[model samples]
Target chain A: MLKVNDINVYYGNIHAIKGVSFEVNEGEIVTLIGANGAGKSTILKTISGLLRSTTGSIEFLGHNISNTPPHKIVSQSLAHVPEGRRIFLQMTVQENLEMGAFTQDGSKLRQDLDDVYKQFPRLNERQRQIAGTLSGGEQQMLAIGRALMSHPKLLMLDEPSMGLAPILVEQIFDIIKALRDNGTTILLVEQNAQMALSIADRAYVLETGKIILSGTGQDLIQSDEIRKAYLGG
Target chain B: MVFLSYLISGISLGSVYAMIALGYTMVYGIAKMLNFAHGDVIMVGGYVSLIAMTSWGLPVWAAVVVAMVACTVLGVVIEGLAYRPLRSAPSLAVLITAIGVSYFLQNSAQLIFSPNPKSYPVIINGSLSLFGGKLTISYISLVTFLVCVIIMIALTLFTSRSKMGKAMRAVSEDKGAAQLMGINVNRTISMTFAIGSALAAVAGVFLCSSYTTLMPTTGSMPGIKAFTAAVFGGIGSIPGAFLGGLLLGIIEAMAKAYISTNISNAIVFAVLIVVLLVRPAGLLGKYVPEKV
Candidate 1:
């Protein structure tokens, strides 16, 4: 389980995230849905310790990870696949996954790597190929696959579907659902509200850095305001 | 026969430059910043080794070990104190800070050891007679080439096979993504500095010993030349730096022998300029277009 307690984040004089809070229990897909610049990624970054939150704390499982460095956060079973898929462009696909298991003591990654390869055989096929040359969809799969290499208890994915094709987007969503079904907690941040809400156990709508609505997946999908504002109904 | 001697000597000199360029290229590769003070670390290593031998009465091997330890500590300290704070600052600011660190090290060396040139004792002696002594190879030159080759091979292995080495390569390619992978980026950068400084120590010893004159500024010209070699090879490419340094050394040695010693440096720079004009990215460098 993870908890974000009323955190506020700032960039210089500008307040980016204001009094935002949320929680995710074990074995659930909790998504934060919003348009561009709605502070969804900022909140995920804050929780992962990539960005500083001036006024609140983030607790992962039981430890207070508000002050933990991003690298330390991953060791505590929290993996963040950042925006743009940020895979090491010049490295081989296999090496990218190996880097994912860096904190897990490099030798113990055989089983973890096998599990990831089983999930995404495309990555396995291109194991020796450089990651940058991969297609947008393949890169997204590699990004998720790299995160999964860490054997995380809770995975935080920022914009997993961005720049992906519709068919590939569906595949990614299926993978997210499968991950959750396998008992891996996921906090997904997405602009694709329809796809995210379809798989999410619970969803939160953020606007201008504050949460505006919260409900179960089906409830939000059927909500007229949600359909109009996010689903484009 | 004269050309052969010059070529051999050029390779000998190039081994030192290649060694120094390893430090430059690796730090540039991983940290994404040019630590100009890297050259001064070589000077510090020279001084440490000099003191260990002349004042402390240590053997040449012990002196090398001592200098390596000293330079490694100094490299980590320099990264911690000078470069780490500028991690997020503009590259221009870091560049200026590096120049400042270079001047600081030079001046500190002058103050501590005096600016006068010191005579460096011969660490490697004797020469092999070949072609009835018409062609000769000094022990130092042979040792320099051998040591440089071993270091290069070792470093290549380190960055390729080891876990920390893999972390270093990942950090070099993408720092933020590397962090997300649970690698301590700062520690990796620090390790980069440490390894670079250790190589610098070896280079410093070989350089001073080969020239037989040690000064506060001994490392500067070679440092500049080694930096040039790094760029010539492609700034962040390891093999590029090695090949560049060797090429640069050969060219400088040839120019000095066939032409005039006074204009050898000018010729070296001229070649560098021409190479850059043709390749844009150093000999081995790849051009990455900036994303708008």
Candidate 2:
């Protein structure tokens, strides 16, 4: 489980995340849904150790990782797939996945590679192809597959469906659900509220750097305020 | 026959420059720093190997090893002390700091070794007869070319096949994402510096041995040329550095022989400008669009 308590993040003079707090329980899919600049990605970045929190703390499985470097935090079994699918463009698909397993010894590396390939068959087909040449959807799959290579305890995905087609988005959501069912905890950040809330066990609605609503996914999806604000009802 | 001889000698000189250029390209690719002090590392390597041979009475092979080790350590120390702290600083600031380091190395060498040039003992002696002894290639030139080729092949294999190599490529692509993958970015950068500096040391030994002279500023001319070669080959591309160094050396040799010795440097830069104008990304470099 991951616990975030009152973390504030800033970009020089601008306050980006204001006292945002959330928790992701084990074996569940938790989602943060909001419009642009809602501090969802900032929260994830802070937890992943890419950015520091000016106030409060983040605890991953009872360990305080607020001050840890990003690489060290990853060794603790937390994987973050940043927004924009930051896969190594020049490297081959297999190489990118290998990079994802950077913390692991060669022992389970082959098994891990097989597991990732099984999840994304397209990646297996293009294992030797350069990542930048892949389609947007494939790149997203590659990003997810790369993150899964680390065998993370908790996986954080930022805007995995941002540029994806509706059909591909559904497929990605199904994959997320399957991953949770298979015992991986997921913290998803999304702009697609309807799709996110449909799969997430619990959901938080963020607006302008603050969490405005929190409830079970179904409740939020059915709530009049969320429906009007995010569901386009 | 004369032209062929000049071409052979050019290749030998180019091999040395290519070795130094590889160091520049690799460091620039991963660390995003020009490492102006890199040339100075070559100078230091020359000094280290000279002292090891003359003062410490070490064999040529042992001296080369000592030079390599010394340069590697110095590189790591330079990264730790000078470049690491400026990781987040602007590129201009890092560039200035690198210049400062370069000057420091050169000045330190001058203070220690004095400004006068010293004779460098021959490490590789003898020559190979070509076309019935009418044309002969020195053993050192052939050895330098052979060593450069071997190192290039080895480096290519290491970067493509190793886990650390994957981490390095990842870091170069995206530092934040690379960390998310659990790569120690700082450690990768340090390793890059170490490898690059060690290569520079190899080049330094070969250069000093061939020229038979050593000076504190000896590394500057080749350093600038190798830097130019890196840029000409497409700054971050490995093969680009190799081709660039070789081509630059060949061009310089041809110009000195045919065009006039005094204007060879000018002609090298002129070729760089023309090639860059034609292909902004350098010979083997790909144009990468900046990500938002």
Candidate 3:
């Protein structure tokens, strides 16, 4: 489980995340849904140690990782797939996955690679191909697969479906659900409210760097205010 | 026969340049900074080796090891003290700092060793006759060329096949994402500097051996020339650096031999300018568009 308490983040003069607090329980898919600049990605970045919180703490599985460096945080078994699919473009697919397992011992690396390949068969097919040449959807899959290579305790995805087609988005969501069913905790951030709500166990609505509402996914989906404001009803 | 001799010597010189250029390219690739102090590291290596041989009475092999170890430590110290703090600073600031480090090394060498040039001991003596003595190849030239080739091949394999190598490539691509993958970016960078500086030391020994002279400023000319080679071959590409160094060396040799020795440096610069005009990314470099 991950616990984030009253975290404030800033980008120089601009206050990006204001007193945001949330929690992700074990064995559940928690999602943060908001429009552009809603501080969803900022919250994730803060938890992943890319950006420091001005106040409060982030506890991952009971360990305070608030001041830990980004690389050290990854060793704690938390994997973050950043907003953009920042895969190593010049490296081959297999090499990118190997990089993902940077903290693991050599003995587990082969098994982890096999597991990732099983999840994303396309990656297996293009193991030797350069990542830059991958299609957008394939790149997203590669990003997810790369994150999974670390055998993370909690997997955080930012905009995994941002640039994909609707069909591919559905496939990705299905994969996320499959990952959850297989015992991985996921904290997903997305602008796609409908798709996110359909799969999320619990969801938080964010607006202007604050959490405006929190409820079970089904309750938010059926709420008139949520439907009108976010669901395009 | 004269042409043959010139070609052989040209290749030998090219091999030396190629070794130094690899150092530049590898450091630039990982750290995204031009280590102007790299050339000065080579100068230090030559001094250390000389002292280890003459003053310490060490054997040739032990002296070479001493030079390499000294350069490697100096490189790591330089990174830790000078470059690490400026990781987040502007490129211009870092560039100026690197130049400062270069000047510091050169001045320090001058203070310690004095400004006079010193002769390096001959490690490889004698020559091999080829084509009935029409083409004579020095033992040092053969050794230099063989060593350069072996190092290049080993480096290529290490980068492609090793886990640390994968981490390095990842860090170069995206520092943030590489961290997300659990790679210690700082450590990878330190390794890169160590390897690069060690290579420079090797090149320095071979260079001093061939030229038979050592001074505080000896590394500057070769350093600048090797840098030109790196840019000409595509700044971050490994094979590109080797090709660039070899090409520059051959061109310089040909110009000095056939045309005029006085204008050889000018000719090398001309080739770099022409190559840049024709292919801005160099021969093996791919053009990367700036992302918004």
Candidate 4:
């Protein structure tokens, strides 16, 4: 559903992502696991068109969206839940969700909001509460819920599990699995390689802005290098 | 009696400033750009209304409607041409561009409209007495005050209840995330400029009607005052700007009555310095954490 090909991202002459490439087929959960400063988030940002790549291209469902404006990317069925829970702090939980479905038409918007509400009933309970006041776990759910409002075919989450408790992390992984089961392709970037590998169909390990390892999740988990380097086994 | 008269007039003037200040708050809240040309937009709006009513021979209502439409279009154009390209530029660059736009608009007005002030033909001629001999408010003042209050109510409802307003708030909070949610950041920013410029138009007309004079440079003082109001109220908070406007207006009037007109601005700024020293975020603004 999405392909990022040999993209080079520069932040004022610093090559953040050096020729990184990856793909996610429809309905698959593909994760990029790396340590801090490994450029996992930059790759996700480039795919979403938030950052322009000096070289290489991004294709979404067979269309070149590499240079497309960030706003237009969502219309093409790609939504990005950024690194932090960057929820509109002043807005209510319901308002955040409404903002997510900003591109949808009347009936589809209503249905989408309902679907998101169903996925996270806790959001429905706190519909009128300000998002900033919500707990870290709740804000994470709202962030994911807001992205789901776009009804995207592929959702790119940058470290959704970051700062979340281990128990909450497990539940979040379950939600990721459920989302994939329901036909939504996902590109998840995570520091928790073990948890991500458990749910991912395929996985890639990044180092210094380059993809260093690739395998099926279970296979990578069983690999000696992956176990030692990422899984902390 | 004289004191009460000045107070009433000050309230009327303050109301108009509050109306225009909302525009500043709205655009600044979302874009974090001051829209320095906003004041000049108000001046152009006055001329637009003047030409419509005088040269085009339209009725007062028709002229107001035309002026508002024209200014809204002008605002959208300015945002497109001046702001859209520099959306991601550094905050300093945006501020400089805004001042550039401000000067550009003021000079353009000078070229098209005469430099000398022109009087707005009387639309309301009567005055009503209140508080026995203490107060007498002009029909124009009453009308301007009522209109400002109405616009404030409408704006409050729009931000709180309307979907587009919520989209605006969302964009102001996080443009990148807002784009990811399918909210058109550019469009929303354009709309904020449009709405803000439109309200400034209304203020222009009221200001001209109240003072009976319009000039190319008319926007400067009010623009500064409105900017002060925005800062006083807390830059991004709507109600804060409104209260700031009213407070500044009242203080200025009281100073003119008891002290002198020369020191009114100085007093206001001094107040601002003191207020900001105590609450750096202004009255309604809260300190937000920076992104890591």
The candidate maximizing DockQ is: 3
**Candidate 1 lDDT, B1-292, residue by residue in tens:** 8999999999999999999999999999899999898889999999999999999999999999999999999999999999999999999999999999999999999999899999998898999989999999999999999998898889889988888988999999888889888999999999999999999999999999998888889889999999999999999888888889999999999999989999999999999999999998899988888655
Reproduced native contacts, each prediction: 0.91, 0.96, 1.00, 0.91
Instruction: Mark the 10 consecutive residues where model 2 chain A has the least summed lDDT.
Output: A97-106
Return whichever of 2 and 3 wins on DockQ: 3
Quote the lDDT for B233 in model 3: 95
DockQ-based CAPRI category assigned to the predicted complex of candidate 3: high
TM-score for predicted model 3 compared with the true structure:
0.98
Q: What TM-score does candidate 2 reach?
A: 0.98
Report candidate 1's fraction of native contacts.
0.91
Give the TM-score comparing model 4 with the true structure, all chains together: 0.95
**Candidate 2 lDDT over residue span A1-233, tens digit each:** 89999999999988999898889999999999999888999999999999999999999999999999999988899999999989999999999999888888889989999999998999999999999999999999999999998889899999999888999999999899989989999999999999999998999999988999999999999999999999999
What would the per-residue lDDT of candidate 3 be over residues B59-113, giving only the tens digit for each residue?
8888889999999999999999999999999999999999999999999999999
Alpha-carbon runs more than 4 Å astray in model 3:
none
Model 3 lDDT tens row, A1-233: 89999999999989999999999999999999999999999999899899999999999999999999999988888999999889998999999998888888889888999999988999999999999999999999999999998888899999999989999999999999999999999999999999999999999999999999999999999999899989999
Q: What DockQ does each listed candidate score? A: 0.89, 0.90, 0.92, 0.82
For every candidate, what is the interface RMSD in angstroms?
0.8, 0.7, 0.7, 1.0
Candidate 1 residues A85-204, lDDT tens each? 999888889888999898887567888888888999998899899998999999999999999888899999999999888999999999999999998999999999999999999999
Candidate 4: list runs displaced more than 4 Å.
A108-110, B1-3, B131-134, B289-292
Itemize residue pairs with steric clashes in candidate 4.
Answer: B233-B240
Please state the CAPRI-style docking class of candidate 2. Answer: high
lDDT of 2 at A199: 92
Where is model 2 chain B poorest over a 10-residue stretch in terms of lDDT?
A: B158-167
Question: Once model 1 is optimally superposed onto the true structure by TM-score, how far is the C-alpha of residue A126 displaced, in angstroms?
Answer: 1.1
Model 2: runs farther than 4 Å from truth?
none
